[model samples]
Target: MALLARRVRPDDWKPIGVDALEANAMKVVVSTDNRSVIAGPGAGKTELLAQRAAYLLQTGMAPPPRRILAISFKRDAATNLAARVRQRCHRSHAGRLDSMTFDAFAKGLVDRFGQALPERWRPRPDYELMFPNDTAFRGFLFQDVGTPPKAIGSYADLQAISIKTFERSLLVGSPLPVMGWPDPTVGQWAADRFWQSSLHEGKKTFLSFSMIGRLAELLLRVNPIAREALRLTYSHLFMDEFQDTTQIQYDLVRTIFLGTDAVITAVGDNKQQIMRWAMAMDDPFSAFDADFSGKRTPLYNNYRSSPELVRIQHVLAQALDARAVEPVSKTAATIAGESCAIWDFSSPEIEAQRLARFVAAEMKAHALGPRDFVLLVRQKAVDYAAVLEPAFRAAGIPLRNEAGTVGAVMLQELLAEEASELLVKVLRLAMTKRAGRHWTECQEALGALRGISPEDEAAQAIFARELDAEATQLSADHPEPPASKADARTIVDDVLGFVGRERLIAVHPAYAQGGWFEKVVEAAAVHLHGSSAGAADWTEALDTYEGLYAIPLMTIHKSKGLEYHSVIFVGLDDGAWWSFAGDQVEATAGFFVAFTRAKQRVVFTYCAKRGARTKIATLYGLLSKAGVQTIQIA
Candidate 1:
């Protein structure tokens, strides 16, 4: 008789690195039931998910041939979670965990089984992806010729509606009218017409992510074979950033694995639900529990911020939610001096100068690098950049506006693209003289592009040699590194020409197929051109673009899931965050996210001349209640 293998208990698995799994965390990790983990910032949500995945995969709970599907809201989060799991589990076990963005997963399903969709809703094979703005929709309503039909409401009413609102209405085959729509029938008619036109453009189809999701749901709902196949393929499902999930995405999840045997573990903070404008479900935690019969587990310990910083965050938390549970800080204060403060300045110019001085002093005293500090604003980081960039430049410090656009693409988003990453890697390899990890990474990347197996050392060596030859040729072509904006653009173009655009596309076929690869390359060149003004050499320029040596300036929305040693909240006055008065809950959540990003210290800057303080009186009261010191700067 074959001997039964020993079962692995939660206690049997040791924490990797410095990770400390609390008793509750351990229970959640090993539990077989569906779970919804509500964790605050720094609660190690991603780490917990990673540990659970490792536990399930290592113990044969999921077993071979049955993979775990981990869907994250952001590409970077997906990449980070996958990397963490790989670090903890064996290679074979880790390979069974497929981590990808929700959009990517949805699009993959639609791309693969779109033909199975009902003919009435089938998308053409060569459909293009469209991100329609309000103007486009209005134009569609007007046919770009005259006023909209009388059945459709006024222009102001149309402006209030979003594409998601329209898509959601169409998905349910009914008009879930917005608050002020003239008539439900008219709204449905307009949505149907817009959707049909978008899906069946002349000789081409343009489908948004929402449209793709609708088709994915239709494909699964109508085809039991496809649904059963997916159910059998994935025994475990992990949803990260659950708060950011939209109704359509939730519907898709419910349609596929709602009552299936697959175990679902969703982790997110309700307080961090800042994507409501994008049609994120309002009460996803409640919905998850109701739909999947999942147990709710709240993680109250914050492992990121120091005690003082956590205390200040609590003050803001209470303002946002009266019944907010204060999160205990697992991190001790290591840095000496005030952990939280409000710096009030008489004018914007004074605020910028003082901010630069403070940052420089902190860098010297704490031995902090540019990446250790982040400057967050309410919105329009370019406007903040215009004010603060000059001061930082005068202080001999480099400041990069990460929220700024490069050829119509946000710099941060552009950098995260696969095409941009591959080009950066190639550039880094070209600049390196000695063979090290870069050479190996380049070889592995090339091997993946060419479908070469990792075990084939001979093939890898040949690729390595080919990479070396290319690097040598590149170096010979450019004797000196780029020193100016024009030089940087020229070098990037040279790399593209030398590496061949087709070869890069092999590594990033999706972006290529969408015609976004060229746009990404253009944005990369634009970013390099702008970065050249701040960097002294090619290496510095790359570092600046990568947020290595330059201080990052971004909007609060862009700073989610990021941590810094110190944070400066710029323009805390009413004018900068005007929307705070209209929607205090969301605005405060945005502030909460920004405040928690600080590991040791946080500074709030308010310029009296910028805006009146009446609109944000409650925030000031909270700061005072938290015992955060206020300094006056002239």
Candidate 2:
């Protein structure tokens, strides 16, 4: 009868973390302690979280705990694991469970603690044509600070933006960041006011983490009742992506859950700290000993990628460690999969598109389809649409990546500009019968661009801005615009609210039709009757179900604890490309992360002009140690 029982809970069955698992038995002194998980790429940190939570649930303890608190970087991830746990555990055994992203989790706490903080306008605004996102936020950060000292851009741009924004808020005492203020026009006085606010005794010292930390701290430390409840409610707190946490975030988490006896586990990959832009704070796992003043455990096994890939990945990450100037840990990882290779392209324009051509050619020769292929890129810096995507569409092949939404947004940005051009052309074409027909065709081509993404704030904004002009022109020439911008926003926002639910609730909205995507696309089609061509551009950009993809185009920052059959790290150039971190010894550790992502083959390509001072050189160093070949672009 005993032999018939399950050897391990399905939730506890993590093949990945088990491979990279480190028996830091000596490090974790307290039976109940904070376990700082340090590992290389695709090490399966998320999988380990499930395993540990499962162990806590199955055994329940000498006296079983009532619930398990699992936190993650993304709600999508948390929702996935929560559903999996529920499926794995029979109804009777699994305790009450709760999972949340740090943002959602913090918001939940705010409900209890921040009731009195003047949130009159904070009760979830009814957004009409609410904008979803803007590239200005991401691309603007790489902004040039301009001219003499005052005009220059640097990492300080982030700080400067914050300080400037705050000063504007303070000077006018405006409750919110001014909506229409572009960088140059944003109130300079506001920046000074923001700077002064930072000088307040209890205010944050550092600009990077000032907002997130200060907000969380305000509730925890200031609200007496809320503080007491936090201590009791989350006795055993589990935090994922601990590496990206800022100092104030660390302090807030540390302050709430009191006592060393309560178990706290922080799982993170320190080598993957590529968020200099987000002011991502660093917490050394070695310090867990003194901070928790307790035990530390290492989950060394990496079950995500192939062993061959992990070997190279480990070397890459080791090279990044500015601390340990030593060699790769002889402890081989157990990742299993095909090897990785990176080939170079002579033409950036033809690369993604030509890569598409290569893939289509491969598919035709090999009898493959879109399902069997994937395209991964580092920075979607330039508008490569004319390069790769249009090529794929011309071939009638589908592809998925962050490119989908970005492409849609890019099209949306062009709606206004394109419409003005098409209108003038049509008017002129109208004067000339033959040319008028072409102008009419151009108008129809302009209208098809839409956001398959439900809450595409960028597209919605651009569409709304140009809707009036398009409507007036259509009344005089073509049929009236399909729907007014306000109505379109109402319908689209409603639809997106549901689609966003999938992102927010994880698994809740299986039945919401079109979710957010249906509405956004519908809005695009409705808004532009003559512009089916534009619609095609927008529809072509939406990529759903990318998880099934094998290949990935990833940022060095996003590649943490993840691996692939092959990896191609692009956009490597000079001018602050290889700045070593604080710990000189730990510098190469980060390189180990990039190296270990490749299992069997490791190939790197960069602008040769960047020369010896590039990440590729560091790759050369690590590969030489592991006997991996370092080849240049053929």
Candidate 3:
């Protein structure tokens, strides 16, 4: 069967690529039962996505009553595609294209069918949705689950697994238990209660991110009218970055559109699915054969990287897993011929400094700016703030750390000051009577304020040397001269008012963008048991705001779906890249994703000795076996 556009002529559409694979994939969009395009890095997947939207619109395949919906993993990605469709497609046909992220689409469904939602999740006047940060979630989990194991000290892992299990159970309509729990019944009970409590705590009602996908899937599965309305609402669905799709996300799509007239186009490269930590499975199309019986297309010609770099990527991928059989031929021009190397260093700090100097020199030689280079890490460890930041500044290199974890961690460090701890204590005492923390938490903050640790006494002597005698005497060890609620409010107002006017707001102009003030308010809210409010504010400050234009230093996960002219990947040691778990397949996949992000040059850096041994990193050995030549710097 040949697919044809309904209302537009052949001249109206522009060719996406000259390659036969890309053209065949586009035509299979309408002619086949369903299509799954496995596109590699720089394989023009974005162009194919845009052209497919234009084709469906131009062909009249998606009329006004039956619109086409395009969903992506990130908001910026969806916005980019929407912009492309508007510019490339005809003005009249562009209106039928609905482009948004999965979360946005789920929110729309919830708003449309509020009554059909589960009773626990039905919409209310004061209902608010919140995607809480790690700090807030950990605080809430501590309160619910009590103090965690001393060895663990945090229930973040448990909370994450519970949430994943909770959402998946809602999708499949079965009570699936989280593994490793001693008693599944008790674990399930606590998870259910936590889920309910997270929705409504006191007068504030906050919605978690997982609930959106779960409830939307539930509504579509249970409500006949809602199902039919959705089935008739969209004619075709195009999902990009399908490899990063989670189980709940996949289940939701399958629940809503299966056995319907919707044409689905799921496009992603299996090798690039590096979000396994977030519960994204290996096979994105695992259910396609059973559900849609889709036809699979692979695009092997990479139009993004140089030929030299492309060969290296192939070796890295194959070293991980030979079954990962998507070899790509480079179709892009080489900017700097064969600019790839592996640098060796004795210490991590020296390695960072050398990277900055190298980047500065590269910019001068290649006519590039700071933005043209990227320094990538496997994880955002303490060195990102301690070593990399100062190293770049010392070299007069304009660099910005794009990893939000670093910003959040730095904020916590700033708040750890003695003067800041006093302000937090005052806030905790003031909020005690309302929606605030427990009395024990208030007492703990007061103790830290009254009796500073031996490590903090030096900073306290400088910042809060002139403390009130009355406040200093009210320590957790000795609670004396108790103050009333009015006194506490006055103390909070005085302390915060003083810090806001004197310390935080009066920071040097150069350091104002460091988010000191935001962190102060957030730390106060967290200590005072108003973390919900703090979570919203802190998340907005980190996620909503963009850093200055400079070289981006981020983790490999953050660098996914993004490319640069020059890339440097540091920390290739065994513990950082390949753990003791012996999962080289997953490790190599991460390296492959990192290597493919460079358009021209790539540099790998590793320390020869982690602590004492002079053993090289296992990744270096793997690459050597793969026949990769490294210009090592001793």
Q: For this target, which candidate reaches the highest lDDT against the unseen true structure?
A: 1
In candidate 3, which residue pairs get closer than 3 Å at backbone N, Cα or C atoms, i.e. clash? 5-59, 6-59
Task: Candidate 1: give the clashing pairs.
Answer: none
**Weakest lDDT window of 10 consecutive positions for candidate 3:** 538-547
Evaluate model 1: give its TM-score: 0.88
- lDDT of each residue in 1-634, candidate 2, tens digit only: 1111124543343322233334442232123556665644555555556555545554453123346576766545565556455444432333344666664465455434444433321221111111211243233333422222354333444434543233213222222232212453333433333333332322232221233234455556556677776555554667777666654455566666645345777776676665433445545455554677634445555544555555555555545554522223333443232245444555555445555565566566656545444333344523433355566666656443333333243232222222222333333332233454544343333322232122355764565445434434433542222235454334334333322434422322211221333443443434333232232321211122122222334344344444443444443333224454343333344444555554333445444433344443554555556655433443
C-alpha RMSD between model 2 and the true structure:
14.5
Per-model clash counts, in order, read 0, 92, 2
Model 1: per-residue Cα lDDT over 264-287, one tens digit each: 999998888888877688889999
By TM-score, is 2 or 3 better?
Answer: 3
For candidate 1, the C-alpha RMSD (Å) to the true structure equals 4.8
The TM-score between candidate 3 and the true structure equals: 0.67
- lDDT of candidate 3 at residue 91, scale 0 to 100: 45
Residue ranges of candidate 2 with Cα displaced over 4 Å:
1-31, 62-65, 91-95, 116-212, 284-287, 322-342, 349-354, 357-376, 381-385, 390-397, 401-554, 558-563, 571-603, 606-616, 623-634
Candidate No. with top TM-score:
1
Off by over 4 Å in 3: 1-7, 10-12, 16-23, 28-32, 118-125, 130-187, 200-202, 332-338, 390-396, 405-549, 578-584, 609-618, 630-634
